[model samples]
Target chain A: DAGITQSPRHKVTETGTPVTLRCHQTENHRYMYWYRQDPGHGLRLIHYSYGVKDTDKGEVSDGYSVSRSKTEDFLLTLESATSSQTSVYFCAISGSGDGLGFGYTFGSGTRLTVV
Target chain B: AQSVAQPEDQVNVAEGNPLTVKCTYSVSGNPYLFWYVQYPNRGLQFLLKYITGDNLVKGSYGFEAEFNKSQTSFHLKKPSALVSDSALYFCAVREKDTGRRALTFGSGTRLQVQP
Candidate 1:
């Protein structure tokens, strides 16, 4: 409950369609991230942002993209939806990524399905 | 690269019993470890973290983790397990060696508390 929110708690989309998941944080945190959780696989990082307009890929970033045009919003986009891409996506925010002080606060999560 | 391992897929405990969720990590530098809990249809809640200082780190919801530098493990423990404590638990780590601040997560272990 660190003032984080993820939209479309549940969604179903067809293959090849584009989908976007939004993560909004009330707190003005400096770091935001997108992660996907699937069976047999722990939470894998999809992408992350350190600051406004700053973004980088995670290990599983192949099929996803992220944007941070504003400080409060981090968006994850699936350019062409695939069945394999269906999973529970989570958004996390942190005041400091250095881990010297604070840990990440996560949103409820968005459950996506690609048919 | 830093990595986390949660060997157990599921852990069952009786009410009022002590519970332990094991987590092992690998990192080049001093690791910054963390534990998070996810309830049904809810986001992940930060339980605790270990950056430095005493090996025994206490956190929210009566949870504590011991950072064993020798064994490279940070196991979460609770004196009493509650039915309400049933949920998915995750172990994560961030290494000072990597440029990216995103955490590497384990597969997750489900804690089932029986009444």
Candidate 2:
């Protein structure tokens, strides 16, 4: 509802293949985040971008990489897909600072399966 | 480190009955607590947040959460449950001391509202 869209709503790929997911936002927020949701682990942050070309890793960023070359787009890439990497990926954007305190706005989500 | 816990994996409630989903948090400094809901095949949606205010915070879809400092808990509640209320709920926490604004999420709780 916050003008966010995730490409490839659903994707199925074989193991060891590379894959990339895209998140586009029209809100022009200052922060973008990539997260993976799996059973027993709710959701874990993979990476986040506070600005263009400024990215940081999260607790579970080992097999994932992210790029934010533009304000409206953020990309998440899996170098070599594994069965364990199969999960629902979500992209979220939020404003900066503690002013609004509003939570992040999430995209519809991308469901990926590595078979 | 900041962490949140949703003790129950699932909760069942009949239509029109009051419902609650438990959440507890651990943080180094003051905590910023939030609640989110996810429907099948959709991304997480923000429900409410407790930054620094009254203990009771109201959110969307007739949902509210009570923040208890002594207990370090923020439990989500609804006056009456509806079938549409059935979904997965997540609790998140952020620590004031940490400059990293990333949120830590709980394992999630599945709510089932039966008619």
Instruction: Work out the TM-score per prediction.
Output: 0.95, 0.96
lDDT of 2 at B107: 96
| Residue clash pairs of candidate 1 | none
Candidate 1's docking class is medium
Residues A23-107 of candidate 1: C-alpha lDDT, one tens digit per residue: 9999889999999999779899999999999999999998788889999999999999999999999998888543435568888
Clash number for candidate 2: 0
Best by DockQ: 2
Question: Against the true structure, what is every candidate's RMSD?
Answer: 1.9, 1.5
Off by over 4 Å in 2: A96-102
Per-residue lDDT for B25-64 in model 1, tens only? Answer: 9988888899999888777878889988999999999999
Write one digit per residue (lDDT tens) for candidate 2, span A1-115. Answer: 5589999899999999999999999988889899999998999999999999999999899989999999999999999999999999999888855234847888999999999
Error of 1 at B77 (Å): 0.6
The global Cα lDDT (0 to 1) of model 1 is 0.91
